[model samples]
Target: MSPVDSNALNELYKAHLAEQQRRTEHALQRGGFDALLIASGIEKFAFLDDRPYVFQPNPHFKLWVPLIRHPDSWLVIRPGHKPRLVYVQPEDYWHVPPEAPSGFWVDHFELIVVRKPEEALPYLQVPGTLAIVGEADAALGDIVPNNPPEVLNPLHYARAAKTGYELLRLREASALGATAHLASQRAFGEGRSESAIHNAYLDACGFAERDLPYGNIVALNEHAAVLHYQYQDQQAPAQSLSLLVDAGAHSCGYASDITRTTGNGDASFQALIDAMEAAQLRLVDRVRAGVDYRDIHLASHRETAGVLRQLGIVKMDEEAMLAQGVTSTFLPHGIGHLLGLQVHDIGGFMAGEDGGTIAKPDGHPYLRLTRVLQPGMVVTIEPGLYFIPMLLDKLRATPAAANVDWALVKHLSAFGGVRIEDDVACRETGAPENLTRDAFAALI
Candidate 1:
């Protein structure tokens, strides 16, 4: 569990509706689209649907987004063209909650619905030319990007920069995640197991009055040595174990990314943690705007190398350590990704703007953010070090390991892993300020 604020969800849709109106107007101003068909964000498929796991009772009952521009408030293309809104069913009035603002639509546009979502296309004022307000199906021919496409993805170019209201919701969500992490920290001990720690997260999320975004990673002992290790991955030896939690809490749609590691109170483990924390700081510093993301990733890699070499894990040569592929054994996943409406936010690369890349190559393929950072953008800066036997086996099979002193790597292998992740916001002065509370970092 990351974090959540029930109050945010109550009024979130109204703000989204307002943004939808702005997007519709902007899309119409761009060209010759007669009408834009809108769809509810809720759907049958399990994950994408915003509804809770238990709410799958009715397939069509999913009313995620308010479909019509407005029932009475419809838009007509110069009084002759047809209006917008293609929906799942064409009958009952949408039950607008009392909190929702009224009158966002003009009566000119027709508010029509249909049993089959695809059937509404034929009714479009200009069937072949309408820009979709939501994700379109692939069966609709060249009208879409490539081949046949049916449903249109209502594109919102404006949502990339978060509004003040959105930031508040996001911060509320992050706090909940912090709460979960603290509770998880308590659940991990020698006799306790990974499942126990994972359950602790769910309990904490419940206590904080929020929902869990995804399952938690409660790796204990040697199991914790492997990054991303959950119950399905592996488990601890019941003793001499540490824990790593890669979990977040989502409120409405905003998410807070955070990771915490456990130590078995061993002296060597503390030294490994010392190195990992220092490397994490170096990586966290890279969250500033205008900094090349690739540079940040590499700087983190090099920083890890500095600490590792002093601990005698590898030779001091940064390039040589990289060439040996020893670093990949510990940290396989990317440091972080954009956080917002989705667990992995979009606008990675905009349509018309040139999104340049500075972070590239060797073990960084999953680097989600490729462009320079910008103010108002939220990102997680998570850096970790883990040890997995399979990865160690692979490194041993390679010739590069000849240069790697395995005895040194082996010494720290049993120490489990250390990861420290924090949510940050890019400032106007090209620096990232921590969105998490000061006390949280103080514990580190």
Candidate 2:
């Protein structure tokens, strides 16, 4: 692994600060606020216990400083002067408290340490003029006011187009994830249990489960039919047929959501995987500036129908299958979603910085991202097909039942599903860059 370029990171933060300040100033003008007061957020206890769950700092606070080392900190940003940071260093015996943060980024902020949350309140002037931008901090609630959507929408919208710095981290995160995916694929091909394959992924990525952006989905055979499959069987099935691994890795608070499917002993299943991969690549090529994402999503449904018809899995014409919703039973969910700091990052449907949102099409309600393609935006293109019993059963009762080849369905159902996903970044020109594929190539 190569070292992170600290100067580049500093430059990224500088660009991010400029963008944020622009959004904040616009929002403040629109919402009648003087300054923005942001809390890094505090830890929450797990159910019925004092133990804290994994802590995630507020995206607003982390935006300015990737303060992965500190929690319960606060940030105050105004039009002028250096940004102020209220660093927290707890004096506790049970666990090791964070040391005062020291990094290339530290010099950018005016830092102050407080043992408790209340001690930091005295630093703010005219708190009533400030609009809160993070987790609810009751200590400052009496003074600071809640941030209305007018103030938040623009900031959320600004994140959709990442800085050059964020793009670098995202590429690194995708590379890390692809490394783990290769290990998991090998483990699956070797007949290892789902639990073991998942462990191999973690070992390859060098991170704990809590550190993951989202829970890893390691599904084998029929288990792949479950969209959010969670359980990891302790023992491998006697007949290992298919593997569907949806996992990712985090790099400096950025994430890469990638999925890959592999098959065993069945040429037809391999063909299906190839078809999906080809279809996904074609769709990814369309992810450039000025393209409407919903149109791409609809295009995916059309291609899926074509693939199913080409394979004799569905008998109806492509238009008929799409019109009757027959295509959804086999390949449901959106073609892809925005990928960045969060797995399903925010601002996917927002129409503008003032906070207008667009609704998903009636037939395709599961789509997470509806924004048009733009330069610097990153997204995932995941297209899948499954032989799920429940969906198949429903299809069997519908008018579209005649479209499906029940015999072929029965024959291939045991092999589970096929999904091919890749993370791509929309460019200022030409086709989007496939970050996941580029990462996988590095392994060779």
Candidate 3:
């Protein structure tokens, strides 16, 4: 990434850091509490709003966590004349300075540091329902009603609720992810291996001025069904086949996840994929506040399965098909998760004061949602259909598999999977807007 890419984020982070203070002060007044505490790490909290504040051997350690005791803190600027910041120093970096640009938390907030904070910080000695955040869990202490949720842990809670500035940054990031995907998709059609396409994604990140987030999954045909399969140096097919690539980029400290599936295949397989894309369109265009996300997920699966069964891939009862948990034979993971500071970010599962909920499916132990949808939450609804041996075995062993069309399954077995994911902003008034879908389509 160029210096310009790094500088823009630095400016964005400063503005966000200022907002953290405003939110903290509001929390203190309303909760009748003393302030908040945050525990950070060098490798754990790797967020860069615009640029790195302190360059570390490990690049992901930079972050700004807030300590707020009340909800109103987000709206008020502390009653005290100025805000306070406890700047901890890693034992090794105790002598070096903050390592960030000038004027970072120097005037408005007090900066203090402690070594081995969990074992030695004087503030943790403060006796109140301390609402700890970030790495503050057991180190700062636990939360209790008598002690109360004074300190919010996982600072990601507030992060899940994007700021106007953050939304703008995310928009740009989404666009970049689309651009990268398209480049890699083109490489796929040209007979590039899955690894070749994967490299294209990294190159896109560099050119787009972003640090490549996580390694991407570029699966073609049977390889796509492996889900999360990383094809680092494998050969790619040259024939009409299905290509499933799940990739994204980390820009301005937020993550953008967008998946696209293209095919050089028979009419039947292509039609099946068209059905998957249609399901994505149906859900992406209507996700707003009050949406029971489970309904959306269920609908996507139901629709995908309906298409497969209609296409003669499955010879089972419609209701029983989904009930048997057969979708795993195709799409193995949750549609998607909350995307932000940490990729999966945080929140969306807990019952927040905001009353939003994203439910987790009992059958799919990994399904992360656990509450009803609410405004201010951003999530991905990536639904997929694949044909994997392990999952197929599990499903076929069940009584519900009796009617599945074995012949059709054989045909789709080589087709792999179809996944379409887009980042969506949940809103109060209308449908949630898709941030990555159009970009993905443009590439195809």
The candidate, 2 or 3, that scores higher on TM-score is 2
- Residue 283's lDDT in candidate 1: 74
For candidate 3, the C-alpha RMSD (Å) to the true structure equals 7.4
lDDT of 3 at 302: 79
**lDDT for model 1:** 0.57
* Candidate 2 structure quality by residue, lDDT tens digits, 1-444: 466677777888788777777877888888788888887777888899999889887777777777765667788888776888988898999989988788767888888888977788777654546788665543463644476787888878878888887888898899899999999999998999999999999999998999898999999999999988989999999989999999999887899999999999698888888888889889989999999999889989998998899899999999999899999999888998988888898999999988787888879989999998899999999989999898899999998897688998887898889888999999999978999999998897
Candidate 1 residue 218 C-alpha distance from true site, Å: 1.8
List the candidates' TM-scores in order: 0.71, 0.96, 0.74
Best model number under lDDT: 2
State the weakest 10-residue window (summed lDDT) of model 1: 54-63
Backbone-clash count (model 2): 0
Residue 269, candidate 2: how far off, in angstroms? Answer: 0.5
The lDDT per prediction is: 0.57, 0.86, 0.62
Among these predictions, the greatest TM-score belongs to: 2
Q: Per-residue lDDT tens digits of candidate 1, residues 217-265? A: 6666566666666473334354645667878886544667788776767
Residues 1-444 of candidate 3: C-alpha lDDT, one tens digit per residue: 112354555566567766666666555555666645443432323475544333211111123432211110111123443534445434455355333223422443554454444433454444544544433222433321132343242233455667654665566678788888888878877888877777787787565322555557788888878778865656656563777878877554567877888888588788887887787878786677887766676676677777767777877666877887766566677766777655676665766543345456666656666556777677888888888888888877887678788778878888876787889988778778677865555445
Which stretches in model 3 have alpha-carbon errors above 4 Å?
A: 1-19, 26-33, 37-40, 43-149, 153-158, 207-210, 237-240, 353-362, 438-444
Clashes of 3: 32
